[model samples]
Target: MRFVPLSSRLLPGYGTLVLAITLVGIGVSITRPYLSLFGTDVVHMSAAELGLFMCVNGIGGILASTWLGRLSDLRVAKKYIMLVAAACSALGYGSFLVIHSYLPLLIVSTVLLGLGASAFPQLFAYARETASRVPDVDATFATSSLRSFFSLAWVIGPLLGSYLLQAYHFSGLFAATAFLFVAVLAIVFWRIERRPPAGILGSQPVKSFAVLQNRHVVTACVSYVAVYTASSMNGLYMPLFVTKALHGSDRMVGSVVALSAGLEIPIILGLGALSARLGKRPLLLFGSLCGALYYVGAWFAQRPWEMLALQLFCATFIAISVSIGMSYMQDFLPDAPGSATALYSNTNNLGQMLGSLLGGAIAQWAGYREVYLVCAVLAATSWLFLLRGKRFKAQEQKALRAALTSQDIETTQTRRAANGD
Candidate 1:
């Protein structure tokens, strides 16, 4: 069969999923950057207290990714799960209007909205699995293309948040975010929930974590965790490096962030296509190496502008890892795209937890620059796991073939015995 382009294979309803993601991204970006500020400035909580509160959000993400992500794969409607997630997000964000204390902020941000944010990954899983039904579609590329919508959201969300902050303060920002999620829930519930695409029905219930049994999946999970952890560490400390280490202004930090976010959109969309051509492994390896090199270069930056320039490389690594990483995970666990992408996302949250703690400790003990060195080491370690996964692929394929052959033989013997009797 002739190869069908990923663009042509996308059905109409997939657009709804992408739009939902963009909305969610906007809602999240509006509040995410401000959450710490809100807690510290408005709620009268200390920075330390805010940090602990953020940790609860991370824990929520971890729990949701592991549990709810799999639930969508096990005899449940993914759209309904998505609906529940959105409602929770709305509830969490809206609560900010009434709840000003630290405890309420913690409960809303960490417990409710945090888990609700897991809908992001679930949406990806739904897209990947749904796209797989189309013959000749590059499901990974399609899904990654959808992923870029969030990057687009990142570009606009912060600016929108800033406007809300300047105009209406935290109350406006939270209300706008809550309303945005509610709007998405309404749109998706009407478009997809009322009329889901065909072939989205759940399969027989398998072991909820059965995908973990695959060695390739496990190794890929390790590599994903490492890559995300490094990225997370960079995210946490890069601003400090700009301000304290290199004496850059806040404007410079914002510019660097903007450049990276803007550049990542095209890079991610372009590389999603590239992965369809060169395959996911090479892309994954290349991305990981770039990440390692980018961090190592950060170790020697003498000026803020130099670090800003380095974001070019950082953008590349991020684009490849996020786009191809999902593709790679789905490749190993073809039968359960929801579970596969969920696990992939879980590693990211796990990485965030580890990276934040590790980076904070390193910064406290050594310095902000030392944190980059640690990130480089971790990125390199992840690359090693990627290599292991590559080498093991052949063995895994051979085992799969053997298992199929044995099952075939057993079926034949049973048929023959029945005929003879």
Candidate 2:
């Protein structure tokens, strides 16, 4: 099946998004993967303190992103908001070099890092709005392309991070992250055009609480939380499940990690192409089932090779949920791009946190295999939640039709005013 590639015509409006997201994605991948190691080895923190550090960072990210998400849809241009987010994230990452103490580090993660992380979702929000103007391109496809750039960055980010970490230590690594974010700022200032607030749909920004009142939004958020939580749990324990239970070596763990990431890049693009034809709900349900299928494979995996091959299902689940899921969430609240992305981001952050905590407990209390079983259950449950909400499409179509009618009226009014009507 042939697909429409990223056309050159779309680049002027969109090219910077690719570059900016790549830089930040690489920067994030470089430092975040090794953060726990830095905390333990550098700060000399106790186990509980380390846990506190991670928990606080996660919570801070949620609150900061959610609040900033709301503010972005208001009077100010989102590009300016994104500039601030990039600066804060840079400061937060750079601070890692100097602040070796736990309390001060906690403060930075809670504020700066939290605020900084909001930029990624804002980038998606910006993409959604911009893509809406470029009618020739499918918005979902544009978002998926951006998501692919981030995914591609992650594939290489770890190797580069390892080199930097080995050579210059955490100082060099964090310094690099800060520098990259600075590049993101330059890209935003120069490339991203200044636009008015999010009125592309001719709808005023609604209150955050009002958006959540929609049944589809709530249902989608909860369902995704389950999928993300399951994915998180699987990621946390997969290594142990291979090593401790299957008696596989670290090679298998590395193989699975690398393979899953490798497979995700293409699948993200492919499913994105299919989305315009197959519709999101079907693909979403299919992805959710993939998660369950992968976990079941992991549960029965006796050899490392068998586990390595199961990455197909794992990659499918991740691509659909991770990349396409954002667009799906936005469908529920087309007018509030910032809020829609923020709500999706919060579910992701919340799910990962829950997975880490719950996965650890399950592994300790039961076994590595049981963790997979529980996650399998969660994945299936998430699918059911989305499936039951089949009526969401009717409302979604009605909203889109209304939005189009409103836009046409506004255009005619603007033309009449220009003619001195």
Candidate 3:
């Protein structure tokens, strides 16, 4: 297929989804960087408590996404799913303004925001399915561009977020996040058109809640978990590490993250274009290597600019891992975009959960800098899993070829017998 420029191939009504996704991106990026600060500064939670808070949040997201993800394939329209998620996000963040207690806040944040998280994967699945219907559109590039647009939102989101945090305080930050989510809900509800479930449209993909069990799929997911865990740890702690340990200001936190996310847009789009030619695994391995280097560099950085400069590698790592990771998982089960993207996205959830729990514990026990060291180790560990996945994929291909050859030979013998040869 000749891949065309995204400008010409917005997949008709897909511009609505893109707008919805970008809203979601801005909404999320606005508050995510400040979660740690909110915990320590506003709620006065200990590190361990923050870890538990994040873990619960992660679990909720996993459960909600898994259920909705499978349901989207079966009967529910993705538009509806996104609507509910966006609403939940708005409610969840809004709730933060009133509830300051630890336990109540944790429960509320976990369920509402966690369920809201499903909108993202569903959005991607919608894009993938939409792209599949249009012969001219390259589904891979389509999805990648969606991610880039989301990143583009981040370039503005964090800077705006920093201002909100400084001027309006955490309450204001959460309020703005909630408002953005409301915008997501409004756009999805009004502008986005609904399609019948993918199954109804005609696809007999693997059914039920069980994820794809192929060796390659499993290994790749495992690798994703490790790499993303490291990335999540960096996200969870980088704000505190800079402010507390390095004596950098709050604005520095936003600047560093926004800079990396800004750099990520172009890199993600380019790699998405090249992914078909270069293949997903090579780009993933390269990304994993970059993740390790960035963390190690971060671990040693004594100044703010050092951390800021490392974002080049950080941008590359995020671009390849996030953009390619979705397509890689989908290829393992091409017929089920919802399930595949869910599976891919859930690996991220698992990683975030572990990273949240682990980062907090490590920071409390050892120190902030040590978390980066741990992240570096996890990044390197991801490469081993990637290598294993490659071998398993090769073996699966070889076995498939052997099965086909044997089937052909048996058919030939049967034909000869029928002819009395």
What C-alpha lDDT do the candidate models reach, one value each?
0.75, 0.79, 0.85
Model 1 alpha-carbon miss at residue 405, Å: 15
TM-score for each model? 0.84, 0.84, 0.91
Model 3: CA > 4 A from native: 1-9, 208-211, 391-421
TM-score pick, better of 1 and 3: 3
lDDT, candidate 3, at 96: 89
- Tens digits of per-residue lDDT, candidate 2, 13-126, equal 676889989898888877765665576679986534654565667688788878888888766688988999999988998899899999988997678988888889999988
Model 1 misplaced stretches (Cα beyond 4 Å): 1-7, 34-51, 96-100, 193-202, 205-208, 243-251, 391-421
TM-score of 1: 0.84
**Candidate with the greatest TM-score versus the true structure:** 3
Per-residue accuracy of model 1 over 1-421 as CA lDDT, tens digit each: 3566656767557778888989988988776655645765678764345445655667788888777766776656678878888999999998888988888667766777766866788788777766666676667668777878887787777677767887898899999999998988897688764323222452332332555666676788889889988887787667667777899864465566667767789988887667756778888888889999899999999998888788778888888888878777766556566666777788888887777667667776788899899999998998899888754364685575455445545766899999994
Model 2 ranges off by over 4 Å:
1-11, 43-51, 199-202, 235-255, 299-307, 363-370, 394-421
